[model samples]
Target chain A: MHPAISVIFFTVTSGAGFGLMTMIGLGFPMHNGIVAAFLSYLLGGGLAVAGLLSSTFHLGHPERAWRALSQWRSSWLSREGVIAIITLLLFAVYALIWMFTGQRIAPLGWAVAAGSLLTVYATSMIYAQLKTVPNWHSKLTPFCYLAFSIASGLLLAGMIGKATLILGLPTPTIIVIALGIAWIIKSVWWRRADTIGFSQTGSNTGTATGLGHLGKVRLLEKPHSGENYLTHEMVHQIGRKHALKLRAIAYILGGIIPVIMCTFALFITPVFFLLIAAISMIIGLFAERWLFFAEAKHAVSLYY
Target chain B: MTLLPAQTNKKLGLVIDLDVCVGCHACVVNCKEWNTGGYGAPLGDVDAYGDNPSGAWLNRIHTFEVTPDDAPAQIVHFPKSCLHCEDAPCVTVCPTGASYKRSEDGIVLVDESMCIGCSLCAWACPYGAREMDPVENVMKKCTLCVDRIYNDNIPEIDRTPACVRTCPANARHFGDFADPNSNVSTMTRERGGYDLMPEMGTKPVNQYLPPRKKSRPEETTEIAPAFVPKAGEGLLGWLDRALEKLG
Candidate 1:
């Protein structure tokens, strides 16, 4: 939960881009012709590829990233890498076919769309499957990922549509609905934070040291004077005051504000409004993802 | 390949005596020294001899002051390393099949060549056993001295973890948990040894011996003093006075 900027940007941008690609794969109708198709595929593809490249900045050996795809049978991370590659490749083919034939292959389009969405799910599972991070371990984690991806995708598509005057209120209405779903999932996830073993009682200092029989065990001294890898990476914590403020920001920007803006966009067809709404939601989702990391308390912190 | 074996032949692990550990950090030091030169990755040291120093160490010693309601405050030294769990999440979560638990001896290991250093295994591990070496850019962890214990060139008595061999207080013991007659197994059975975070379902092979209860004050009243001063022991001139006069 260190909220590394690279990871934050990667998750947010890639998620939105994949969502946009999913929409494209679904053959979203465009009144403004190929611009919608071109913009969605190119922008979405660029964001995803850029996000992926950015993620490798923190790796100790970025060259070995291809090896990560080998363990997909056991690791969600591996699955994510493989699925993401497949999705991106499928999107490329899907785009090429669209460009050359000027005809939509419904089955191939759906496959591309499904692959993109599955990649997002795999990404979410990378965190969701971790029992050590209770805030992310629940079923709600994937639900949030799916909801946010689609919401961001729909909103981005809706913005492109409104900007080009390609489509009508139906896109905005769908964006509004997706935003609401994301809002509900996030609300419940945040609320259940306390109930879902976040307190680390199961693996506290007392239990960790096998000294719980004595009494309350408090840290008398850390193992070292300076921050080691464990303290640096696993013990990233946010203060309560800052966390509360961030939570409010996430709700407003990621959910409520976008809902209101998209609702207005449904009435007023100004390109600026829809565009700004999409941008704000992107920024808002970035905040939300940062909190998703910052708020998760690793089980290892119990020893500290 | 990351899937754990249905059963391991030998659950070889460490058994630590918390009651007797003096917290000297000999185990930590020896672990680093041996592993760095042996099969393990070079334990990197950063900012050594500077205002701040930190590095990757497979084992660490933490100290705690505890005062039970009826007992006097006591300082307990806690030595922590990888427990090599039966359900090693770190191994299972490794995306490159780099982290794995050995079925023959139940020791968890990492193949640095295959490791992408994504650090997902570190997050999956509840014990915080793994350390990312900034120098190597890969995960490093306690291998239970796999190279030492199985090496035929080593003396039979020295065929144990570096930490166990180096414990000044003799608080660390290493043996196969599967062998009922093994020294570690007997000690664990007799001392009521227990696992750390059993609820996590890791089923760690390593065990910790709880602090034994001390006798009440009345019971040891007649015991002789550890040292009895001879005549004229209370003189002002102690060993320091002699050194000062020479100076």
Candidate 2:
């Protein structure tokens, strides 16, 4: 729950990367020619790899991160790592084939698209599977992650389309709609998150300590005088006012502004508007991802 | 390997009595001392002698004030560590095969060699049982003294968890809960032992017996009368008389 910058960058950037790859694999402006196709792959692959590398910077043992892919049978994180690798490999092959041969193999492209989307799903499950943080342990979490990934990915694709003169008239509408849907999903997620923990029945301190029968159980003394890993990692206390302000910033920058920018780009000075839309969306997502970790209440905090 | 065993032969865990625990922190200290040298990595400290000292500790004693609606408030010294649940979310959540629960004894442990120190397993644990070692950057939790309990080098009587062995108030008990006749199981049944956060569905092997109610001051009988001096009762009375005569 620390809202680590490395993790936030990893999720936001990688989600966008995978999302972009999915769009490219599905032939979203990638059929425009060699330069456009190559540029699309480069941007998508760069973002994906950069995000992946950023994730490793937070690891205590980055060299041993390979071991994480072994337990895909149970662990969601393992599944995410394994799927991400497979997706990257497939995306590379698909992009190379398109760039060199200028021929889009239908089956291979579909496989790349599927792989990219599945990677995003696996990434979402990394947080959604955690019952300890009730805010994330919901069906809506995956929905929220996928929506954001797709929307951000579309924004990037729209930018590429405008620059390449391959901008389909309906593409802007689609991107705007995607952005709106992403915000709607996030709004629902925030609504549920606002009432997820402690307030929920059977998820409070009394239930956690098994002392409801005795009435109120209050912490008299903490286990340690100083901050331990648990307090440091799990006990993030974000004020409601600060959180509201961030949410507003996220909505205005990530949601409303992008929608307005995408709509304007459909007619007037298209390239600049699309680029601004994409950049604003990423910044907005960073804020959103930060709140995703900060607002979460781990069940272990009940003891403290 | 992170997958839990379908059934464990022995559910080895602890039973802490809140009534008996005096919050001495002896168990907490002994656990740290023994674990630092006995198993995996030495429990490391950061800024230990400096301002904002923090460290990884396997066991900790939390003091809580319980206020019942019908009774006065009372303090309970709660010593918490790994519960080693039958359905351990921590083990399953481990991306590497680093975290696992033994089928033989049901004690959950981390294989530090394989740990990436992602700290996901710690997040999975609802009891705040796991701690990340600052130096080794690996996950650490109570091993239930797996090194001591089976060590032929140590005396049989001392073959228990360091915390249970060092508890001065006799509040901590360790044994296989799978056996119905075991001391822990019997104590649990007789004393109304219960799990922490049963709704979490962890089905923890460890249990805690609630503190017994305290007797109110008015309910206690006053037996001894106020002191009154008798003339020839004893040396004290004679001295008092002699002093009076002199006066």
In TM-score terms, which candidate is top? 2
Best by lDDT: 2
Mark the regions of model 1 whose C-alpha exceeds 4 Å error after superposition. Answer: A31-36, A162-169, A194-201, A238-241, B218-247
Cα lDDT of model 2 by residue, A140-255, tens digit: 99899899999988888878764333354467788888888988899998999987765543677777767668879999999888889998899878533389889999999899
Per-residue accuracy of model 1 over B31-113 as CA lDDT, tens digit each: 88998888756888888789888888999989887778787777889999999999998888888898988889999999888
Collision pairs in model 1: none
Comparing chain B with the reference, what is the TM-score for each candidate? 0.87, 0.88
Off by over 4 Å in 2: A162-169, A199-201, A238-241, B217-247
lDDT of 2 by residue, B63-99 (tens): 8888888778988888899999999999998999999
Per-residue lDDT over A38-118 for candidate 1, one digit per residue giving the tens place of the 0 to 100 score:
665788898888888888877778999988888888999889889999989988887776766666678888998899899
TM-score of each: 0.91, 0.93
Q: What lDDT is reached at residue A217 by model 2? A: 92
lDDT of 2 at A181: 92
